[model samples]
Target: MLRIVLLFLALGWNPVAGAAEMGDDGLHKEDWFSITFRDVAEDIVAAKGEGKRLVIIFEQRGCIYCREMHEKLLADPEVRDFIKANFKVVQYNMFGDEEVTDLDGEMLTEKTAARKWGYVFTPTIVFLPEEAPQHVSVRDAAVATMPGAFGKWTFLNMFRWVHEKGYQKDEHFQTYHARVIQEMRAAGRLDAE
Candidate 1:
């Protein structure tokens, strides 16, 4: 029992505790993530119905960046809770054999979809608007895409930015993040980086 606990601690499993469960597909499982039929259009409708933005995350098995994201950013309760409350996240395995229905009505396997979408990274996160354009693929319709892992503040801020529809504003993500960082520092919620 002690050895098991030690091993788990070494693997960064304790902070997330119950949240660290892994699927057979080797992706970390979050109970709040929407499990659907992999239909992009239907997913948009479902997310709208729930008053949440749509997020599609592409991850591959044995991806260290994916593991880091799951173990660190997603594990932090502030980040986890905010994202769960605001986003309807649908996870896709970048190299998997699962069939996905794109918004343009094209049916392709996960790997093919990744190639079609031009996602070359393991942890590419695609954020869709509240209403996607008709007859467009998710890649084309996405308001923003984060291609790699980031620290907790950046990750959480990205989610917040999308939820706030920051893409539609004059301020870019870098500006928004910088402004928020200053605010957080002023409020003493975050220390200097």
Candidate 2:
């Protein structure tokens, strides 16, 4: 037992080893996030061109839940890899003055856009479909909106369901999440506790 402990210590093994770095805006920064002009229509087009779905994540400085999400759930290798492979993520500051163009061709500041979209929480994640209809705002065309932080399984499953286009199916997200949890538990990937 002592030798095993010494080996782990020498190897510098850490359970939470891969947390992303925080940006000057006090948000977690990752290489997977796109640095775009914040134009909804153009972003959607670009994301689709890359064969990836568009995902806008809104966060503010000093949000504990956002910190938890970035540090714990998103830091997980499986979740991070899946997101990087399948989604074009965009980070938006909830209270920022940066200009953003809405899908309907309206220009607004990030804060105004957040209000227009009715997002009341930090760490709100908006998932867009492959194609959006003309003359509609992003909020009107979003397929799914995650309002706040969630557990590792829920967060990963949400991304998976969206990537698989499960919204078109009859199965609800709650049901799907339960099924996924059961499968993970059975596979011993998740602790039963």
Measured by lDDT, the strongest candidate is 2
Point out where model 1 deviates above 4 Å: 1-16
Residue pairs with clashing backbones, model 1: none
Each model's RMSD to truth, in Å?
Answer: 3.8, 3.4
Give the Å shift of residue 133 in candidate 2: 2.1
Q: Write the per-residue lDDT of candidate 1 for residues 79-167, one digit (tens) a residue.
A: 88999888999999999888899989999999999999999997999998787568888889999999988888888899999998999
Report lDDT (CA) for all predictions.
Answer: 0.88, 0.89
Every model's TM-score: 0.90, 0.88
Model 1 — which ten-residue stretch has the worst lDDT? 12-21
For residue 5, give model 1's deviation from the true position in Å: 8.1
lDDT of 2 by residue, 1-193 (tens): 9898779878998644566788888888876689999998888899999999999999999999999888777777888899989999999999999899998899999999999999989899999989856799989999989999888888889999999898899988889999989888888889522
As a whole number from 0 to 100, the lDDT of residue 29 in candidate 1 is: 77
Give the Å shift of residue 75 in candidate 1. 0.9
